[model samples]
Target: MRKNIMNRLPVILPVPAPPPPAHRAEPVLDLAVPVFNEEADLEPSVRRLHAHLRETFPYPFRITVADNASTDATPLIAARLAAELPEVEWIRLAEKGRGRALRAAWSASSAPVVGYLDVDLSTGLTALLPLVAPLLSGHSDLAIGTRLAPGARVVRGPKREAVSRCYNVLLRCTLSVGFSDAQCGFKAVRRDAAARLLPLVRDTGWFFDTELLVIAERAGLRIHEVPVDWVDDPDSRVDLLPTALADLRGIARVGLALARGALPSGRPSRSYAVPVTVMALAHLLLYAALRPAAAAQAVNALSLMACWVLAQPVLGRPPLPAPPALPALAARLAVTAGSLALLRHAAPGAGLRAELAVLAAAHLSLALPVAVARSARGGRRCRTGSAAS
Candidate 1:
């Protein structure tokens, strides 16, 4: 009976599929576009970009457009482009934001060299070649098309130029950002870098580009800034004051992140002394508020504050060698000033209480390490080490 049953059943084993080939995958250059309500410029810009890509970049290429929940004919145009161009694909973003859309598109694309150019083609199609060249050649991990550099030419109105200069100056001074012009939208990165940056960044609005570049810089990646001919599109989406304020906030965030060593190095330090300097100035302001002639006293106080703040970092403790607590104190002061500054700017009188609170917090933050050190030394003196043991 067992032999008969075994013979009746046809033994079947599943066929094993071969493993994927071990050959290295070729890196494909993808031009990632974040398109919002760009219905008017959609076709023309895409055509121009396609033509440029065809003429230049003699490698595999694909265009990924993240259609940012456009309210106009932008989505329709993107769908049509995707259908017409084999190398083109559209990623629909439910929310609308230039930076957000671009990030979505880059993440969805399957190319190695990911890049984004303004929908208006402000940086010109000619600049695209150099933008992605560094990534392709393996010379640089990221490339940015800069408009304010020496060889770059900007054909915008005087107002735009003035605003751009002022905005950049503020960023440089506050964040100590090394980039000449961080706002230029035409930037590209290697697939690895793009993949790394897309998830690390949180801002999805106009400030996204700035955050991306800063993160890249902090990651110790070589960012090549390429000068290009940039003419401002009359229909630029940026609002003057609001956008300026937003960018300032972004700069501050980037600076704080950098100081905290949050991006790549992952080290902790209180090296942000600028905020302490600002706090010292605030103290001076408070003194002046009480007495007009107190400015001299305030100045002396500020000088003392500066010296104390500077000395801890520059001069290490003799007995114990460790990171200077100056950075830690400065960081605390900066945190306080930033909060107070925002409140003061947004709601002038409401920040007074906040200012007092922050000042107290700053003093505590600065004093803790010294207090701890002193306490430890006193405890050491009170005990005979081996005898206590």
Candidate 2:
């Protein structure tokens, strides 16, 4: 988040380009291939993708080679391809970051559905249609090729695989993200969605992908995931340790931003985090303090009930919500009452430690889902207000 949000805007304005001849159809999908120092792989990958799109893709498509400060022959090759292929174009940037390349090219694309693919082409090109179909049809705000989802066939080394899983798990636990994969290079977004989200995103490096998705999810945009066939690039140049460390820092930054409600969304800020945490500790202490006077189950029930009553006011929504089919007030009462009774009976003979664990688990399980639900619901009211500037 260190980068100025103002620096990220201004790219969305109309970009200069040579006007095509009359009767030349506008591309429905504009795919950006971000590259850096990949002279050898650039040509073949671009050609392969072009050929594949030409042979199989139903609608008109454009392939963009986004050269991000590559010192090698990559720029020359990209230029040649753009001049040779009618559907190919190239964008030059002085900086070196995948996110920079994407933002420059994606922000300038004329196509309604814009996406990016890694220059290595590790993901199967066969999944391209499925990836962008939703965005093209206006069914989803964004789509990503997921390697972790069911039916996804991926071939990669164990170490990278472990790191990928751990990174995603950290997102889930810390950020409450709904999407399965974050770093996958194969992703697409509607032009309007990108217009709204890019201004809010500050990371112009590896963290850009995650920051975009987090903002999208919090804004309650519909994100579509397509299980894909992926193969690891054997000669990939990315250094995992440095990248992983950077990603951790990015997560912490985004988490803090969300807590302060710095983002422009309807989702509640996590200002209650401190007070709520203190409340939990106090509840536990109250139970322990009363242990000498009452049974464990009685103390548990009383402490939990007191906390529930206090939460109504602490949450700032004094009146409970009204559910569509079920009464919100009744549902809340039933759930709270049922959870307490079960907590009382679930560990009747257990020691202090076990009972406390059960109490904490039930509370967490109940709370986490509500937090996630609120995040998702915020998307429906997602706004790209000028407040971000």
Best by lDDT: 2
Model 1, 1-389: lDDT tens per residue?
Answer: 53454243222211111332466344387777777788889888888888788788688677777777666777667777877766666766667777877776676666878888877888877787777777888999989888788999889999989988877775665555678888887988887888888887878888898888777776678889899999899888778877865675566556555554566742233343333333333353443344334433343345445645544432342234545566654565465456556656776665334555555455556646755786687588778675677
Candidate 2 per-residue lDDT, tens place, 240-307, comes to 97797678667756765675567776554454442344344445556666767887667766775675
lDDT of each: 0.67, 0.77
User: Alpha-carbon error at 370 in model 1, in Å?
Assistant: 21
Cα deviation at 335, candidate 1, in Å, is 20
Poorest stretch of ten by lDDT in candidate 1: 9-18
Q: Residue 250 deviation, candidate 2, in Å?
A: 0.6
Candidate 1 overall lDDT versus native? 0.67
